[model samples]
Target chain A: MTASVLSRPRPAVATPTAAKPRRRLGPGRAIPFGAAIGPVGLLTLWAVGSAAGWLDPRTLSAPWTVVTTAGDLIANGRLQDNLAVSAQRAGLGLAFGTVIGTVLALASGLSRWGEAILDGPIQIKRAIPAVALIPLLILWLGIGEEMKVLTITLGVLVPVYIHTHNGLRTIDSRYVELGESLRLPPGTFLRRIVLPGALPGFLLGMRFAVVGAWLSLVVVEQINSTSGIGYMMDLARQYGQTDVIIVGLVLYGLLGLISDGAVRLVQRKALSWRRTLAD
Target chain B: MATHAGGLTATRTVRVRSLSRGFGDRTVLNGLDLEIGEGEFVALLGRSGSGKSTLLRALAGLDRDVAGSGQIEVPQNSSVVFQDARLLPWQRILDNVTLGLRGPEAPQRGRAALAEVGLAGRERAWPNELSGGEQQRVALARALVSEPELLLADEPFGALDALTRLRMHHLLRELCTRHRPAVLLVTHDVDEAVTLADRVLLIDEGRIRVDLTIDLPAPRSHRQPQFLAYRESLLQSLGVYQTEG
Candidate 1:
C-alpha cells in the first residue's frame, strides 16, 4: 500500500503553450461587423425603398432627410439646448436616486431590524412601476422640471436597491468569519469587505439605473412644456415632421450606448482582480 | 489544568471545560474537556459527524452562534486557516495577506511571510491567478503573518491532490516547527494525522475516544514499524480494522 500510493503518478503541471497567431477577420475581429450589420442593413433597405418610391415619404422620411434635419437642428442650436436640458435632468435624477437607493440598501442589508422595517415598503414600491407614479407626480409637483426629474429618480431607485441589497446579503460567510477571527472593527469590515464584495451588484444596478433614467426622461418630457429630445419629438409628431422625430430618437440611442459604455469601462477597472473563464 | 508530559512544561494555549454544543435537538459536542499546550501540534481525527470542525470553530471563536455552555480559554491572538483559502477575491495577494492588519511594518511582514511560503515574487498577483496549492500556501502565509499563538486549521489540504497534499504536509510540519504555534488540525485522513502531529486524537460521538502520542523522530517515514503501528491503532480507533483471512 505504501509503495503503490507513494509512487503514484503525480498530476502534471499545465505547460504554457505558444498561442496560435490569430487569422485575419477571425471571430474576434468579426464581432463589430456582425453587430453593425442589422442596423446598417435596415438603413440601406430604407434608403433603397425611398429611392424606388416604394414607401410613402410622409410616413418615414429618407435617411438623408433625417440627417439634414439633424444638421439644421444642430446649426440652429435647438439640438444643443434640448440635449443640455435632458442631460441635466438625467444626471440629477441618476445621482439622487443612486444615492438614496444605495443608502437604503446598505441600511437594510447590514442589519436585521433595518431589513424587517425597510424591505417591505421598498418591495411594494418596486412592484408599482415608476411610470404609474407620473399622474400623481404631475399633480403634486406640476409638469415642470421637478416632476420630470422626480420621474427619472423614481425609475432609477428600484434596480439599485434590489441588486445592491442582493450583493450585500450574498457576501461569502467565510469572509465574515475571517472578519470576526481577525477582530476587525465594524467600520473596517464594512469598508474593506462588505463594500468591495457588493460592488459587482452595485455596478449591475447602475446599468439598469442608466436605462431607467433615459426611459423616464422620455416619458416625463413628453407630458408638458419641456425642452428636451422628448419635447422635440412631441412637437414634430404634431407637425408630422418624421425626420425631426427620427433625429431625436437617434440621439437618444446614441446617449444610451455612450452611457452604457462608460459604465462598462468603470466595471472593467473596478473588477480587474476577477479572473473569468473568458480570461 | 496543567499536565506535565515528556519533560516540557508548556503553558496551555487552549482550554475547554465542559464544552457542550447542540444544533436543534442534536448534540454535536457533549460535555467535552480538553487542553492544548503552547507550541504543541495536535491532530484531531473523527468521522463525518464527530464534531471535529465544531470543536475547531469553537476554539477559533467562530461558533458563537451555536447553543453551548462552556468555558473556552483561547488566546486573544489566534488565526484560522480553512479548507478553502478564503482570500478576498478583490484584493492583491500581498494585500490579502495583510488584510485586517495595521501598523507600518504590515506590508513588510506580509512580503516576508509570502517569501517564507515560497511565493516571493508573486506579491502583486491576484488570488485567482494562483493554482489551488499556491492559494493554500497564500492562506498559510496570511495566517502566520500575524504570528498567532494558536493556528486552527480545518482540513486545510483536504481539497488538494495527493502529491500536493504530501508537499503541504511537509510544509506545515516545517512551518509548525519554525513558528512554534499551537495547532489544531482537524482531518479525516489517518496517515496525515500520523505524519504531522505530536499527538493524535480520535473523536467519537462528540467525545475524545483515543489520545495517543506519536514519539517518532523528525522527518517521520511511513515505512517505519512504529509509524505503521500508530496508523493501525488510529484506523482501529476510527473502526476500520484491517482484516486477515
Candidate 2:
C-alpha cells in the first residue's frame, strides 16, 4: 500500500503553459517612455492648434515659439542670470531651514522640557501659513534678497519639523530596550540608532522643502525682486511676451522635479536595508 | 514556607531580599525573595500573568519603574535575551553580535561567538535576511560574546518551532555548560524545564510556589522515568494534570 501510494501520479492541474506570456515593462525601462508621453502629447496638441490657427499666438504661444524664445534668452544671458539668482536664494534658505528644523526636532524629541517649551510655539507657527507672513516680512525686511530667502526658509521649516519629529518619536521601543539593556551611552545611542532611524522621514521632508522653496520664491520674487525667473515672467507680462513667460514656468517645473529626484536618490541609498513588496 | 540557603559565598550570583513590585494598585511581584548560585541553571515556570516575567525583569535590573523597593543584587556584567530576539534591523549580523562592545578584539571575538553558534561566514547579512531560528542564534551569540556573569533569558525560545526549539535546547545546554554563567530561564513549558534546568521554581500568585531540584544525570532523556516524574510533578504544581491513563 505504501508503494502504491508513492507511485500514484498527481491529478491534472493548471500547468505553466495554461497562462499566456505577456510582455510587461519593468519600472526602470518604462520611466523615460512614461515621462515622455504626457509632455509630448501636450506639446503635439499645442503645435496642432497653432498650425490650424484655432489658438491665437498672443494668448498661448506655440511650442516652437517658446523653444526659440528660451534659446534667445540663453544666448543673451538673461535666463542664466535669473536662474543663478534663484538657485542661490533657494540653496541658502534650504540650508538654514534644514539645520534649524533638525536641531529643534532632536531637542524636542529627546527631552520633556524641550518639548514643553518648543511644541506650543511651533504648532502655532505651523497653523499660520508662511505666505501670510509675506506682507509683514516686507514691512520689516523690505523685499530684498533677505526677504526672499526668509520666505523660503519659513516655508521649508514646517514640513521638516513635522516629519522629523514624528520619526524620532516613533522609533521601535523594542530597539530602545535593547539599547537600555546593553547600557549604550547616550551619544552612541543617538548616533547609531536614533539618527539612522529618522533619516527616511528627514529625506521625505526635504522633498517637500524643495517644492516649497520654489513656491515661496515665485511669490517673493514677484513681489519686488530685481532678479529671478519670477521677475523675468513679470517683465514678460508687462510687454505681453507670452513665450518668455512659458519658458519661465517650464524652468520652474524642471527645477522642482530635479531637486525632488535628488532627495529620492539619497533616500534609496540610505535606506537600502529596508525590504518591502515594492522592491 | 520559604527555604533559605544561608551563607554569603562568593559563588552566589543573585540575591533578592523581599523585592516587591506593583502597577497602579495591581500587584505583580509581591514581596518575592530568591537566590541563585554561580554557574547554576534555574528555570521559572508559571501560568500566564502569574509574575514569572516580572520577577525575571526585576532580577535583570530592568524594572526600575515598578513600585516598591527591595535589595536586589546581580553581577555588573549581565545580558538579557528577549523572546523576540530584538536584533537591530539596520545592523549586520556581526555588528549586532558586537553591539555596545568596545575593544580592539571585539569584532574578532564576535566572529568567534558566531562560529560557536554555527553561524560562521554569515557576518555581513542583515538581521531581516535571517530566518527566525537564525536570528535567535544571533541573539544568543550577542549575549554570550560579552562573557556575562549572569544570563537572563525571558522565554527566548518561546517563538521557535518544535524542531528548532529542540535544537536550541541542546545548543543552549551545551553553551551554558561551557560558559558556566548563572542562567535564569523563564519558560511556560514543563518538558523544557525538566529537560534543561538543574532546579525548577513554579511561581504562582506573585510568589514562588514550588522549588524543586532535578538530580538526574547529565544528557537526560525524556524516556527516563525520573524525567517524566519531574515533568508530572511540576505540571501538577502549575495546575495541569495529565488525564492520560
Candidate 3:
C-alpha cells in the first residue's frame, strides 16, 4: 500500500496530509483459518515438545502448563486482583489520553495560534519515547498507579493527536467550498465536514494508541510495583517459575490482540465509507 | 416558449458589475459584468484560464475572501454544483440531498427532488456506490432540493461520459422547468451550450466577449440549421476556426 502511494503522484488537490487515499482498492482475499494457523501451529509444537520431554520445563513451559498455571492463579484470586488493577490502569490511561488528545488536536488543528503553541511541544513529545520518561515520572509522582497511568496516557496521546490533527488539516477544500455555498452554519459545518473528515486519521491513530497503551503498561507495571501481570512476571522471575511467567506473557499478548481487534472493529464500522486494503 | 428578452424586467436573479479577482500578481477576472434574469438559463463558454470558474465562485460567495472586489448581488438561497459531484462520501444519498436543509419538510422535499432526478428509492445508497452519472444526479437533487432562486453549475457534467452527459442535460432542462431557477452553467462544449441554454456567453480575457440569445424551437438538435450555425460561431469564438477533417 505504501509502495503504491509512493509510486503514484496524486493530484495537487490531495496534499501530503490528506487521510491516506486508498481509492477503489477492492476488498482483498481472505484465507480460510488464516489467522489461527500460526498460533495453533506454535501451540501444537509446544505441546508436542513437552509431551516428548524434549523441552526443559525451567527454560520453557509447555502450552498446557501455562494454561494450568493461569487457572491456578485465577483460583487463588491473585490473578483476578492483578488483572483488575492492570485493566483499570490501561483503561483509565486510554480514556484520559483519548479525550486529551482529541481536544488538543481540535484546538491545534482548527486555529493557527493553537498550532503554533501546541504543535511544537507535541512534536517534541513524540520524539521522546514514553518509557524513557519513567525515571523522571517516578521521581516526580512516585511509583504509584498515577505515574503508570500518566506514562500510558503520554504514550497513547501522541499518535492520536498527530493523526487526528493531520486529518483535520487535510480535509478536501471542495467540501469546504460546498459547505460555504450551502451557507451551512458553523456547527453544521464542523459536525458534517470537520469531524467526519478527521475520523479516518483519528481511527488510524487509535490503532497505534491501543498498542502504545499496552507497550507503556508492560514497562509501567514493572516499576517498584505490587500488582498487574507485569509485576506477576517480575515476581515469577525471582522464583524461577517459568509457567507463571509464560502465563503473564500470554495474558499480555491476549490483551494486546483483543484491544487492537476492538479498535479495528470500531474503525471499520465508523469509517465504513473508506475503502482501504484492510479487511 | 416565450424567450426572455434582454429587457425582461421581472427580476434579475443575478447581477455583477466590475468584478475583479486576481491570483498573486496575475488578474483572472478583469472588471467583468454579467446578469441573469429570473428563470433564465445562461451557459458560459470559456477556455481553461479565462476566469469562468473564478466568476462563478465569486457569485456563489465561495471566494468572498479569495477574490478581489466586485459589486455582486445574487439570491441568498443560491446553490452550486462543481465538476465532481462533491457528495459527502460518508453520508447516505438522502443525507447528501438534504445536507444543509432543515425542518421536517426537508426530507420529504429531498425525496421528491431525488425522484424528480429519477433516483427514487436510492436514499440509502452511498455516494461511492453509485456510478459517476448517478452521483452527479444526487448532486443535482441536492442543488435543486432547496428550491434555490439561482443555480450555479461549474461544469457539473464535465466528468461524465458523453451518453451520461446527454441524459443529465435532459434531466437538468426538465428540472429547471419545474423549479424555475435562474441557471448559469459553465461548460467548454459548444453543442451543450447551444442545446440547453436560453443564451450562450463566450468569455475571453476574463470578460464576456459575445452574449448570443438562442431563439431556436424546442427539442434543439444538432441537425437544425440554426443549431449548426450557433455551434460553429461558438467554436470560432473559442478560437477553433474549423475542423481539419
Q: Write the per-residue lDDT of candidate 1 for residues B1-245, one digit (tens) a residue.
A: 25656433458788888998899999999988788888999999999999999999999889878998989989999999999999999989999999968999999999999999999999999998999999999999999999999999999999999999999999999889999999999999999999999999988888888999899988798889999999988988788754631
Q: Pick out the ten consecutive residues of candidate 1 chain B with the lowest summed lDDT.
A: B1-10
lDDT, residue A237, candidate 3: 95
Candidate 2, residues A1-279, lDDT tens digits: the string is 999999999768856765787667665444656868998898889999998999899999988899999999999999999999999999988988888888998998889999998878888888887778889998998878888898888888878887899889989988888888888899879987899888878888899988888887888888787899999999999999999999999999999999999998888888888896657
Candidate 3 whole-model C-alpha lDDT, 0 to 1? 0.90
Return the TM-scores of chain A for each candidate in numbered order.
0.87, 0.87, 0.86
Output the better candidate (1/3) by TM-score. 1
Q: Kindly list the per-residue Cα lDDT of model 3 for residues A186-278, writing each as its tens digit.
A: 889999999999999899889888878887888988768999989999999999999999998888898889988998899878988877655
DockQ of 2: 0.51
lDDT, residue A262, model 2 = 92
List candidate 3 segments past 4 Å from native: A1-30, A51-54, B1-10, B64-67, B242-245
What's the count of clashing pairs in each model shown? Answer: 0, 0, 0
How well does candidate 3 score on lDDT at residue B207?
A: 83
| Per-residue alpha-carbon lDDT of candidate 2 for residues B1-245, written as tens digits (9 for 90 to 100) | 13355746767889988878888988888878888889989999999999889988888778778787788899989999999989988788999999878879999999999999999999999999999999999999999999999999999999999999999999999999999999999999989998999899998888888999999998899889999999989887877655652
Model 2: residue A139 alpha-carbon error in angstroms? 2.7
Cα error, candidate 3, residue B62 (Å): 2.2
Displacement of residue B73 (Cα, Å) in model 2 is: 0.5
User: What lDDT would each prediction earn against the true structure?
Assistant: 0.91, 0.89, 0.90
Candidate with maximal DockQ? 3
- Which model is ahead, 1 or 3, in terms of DockQ? 3
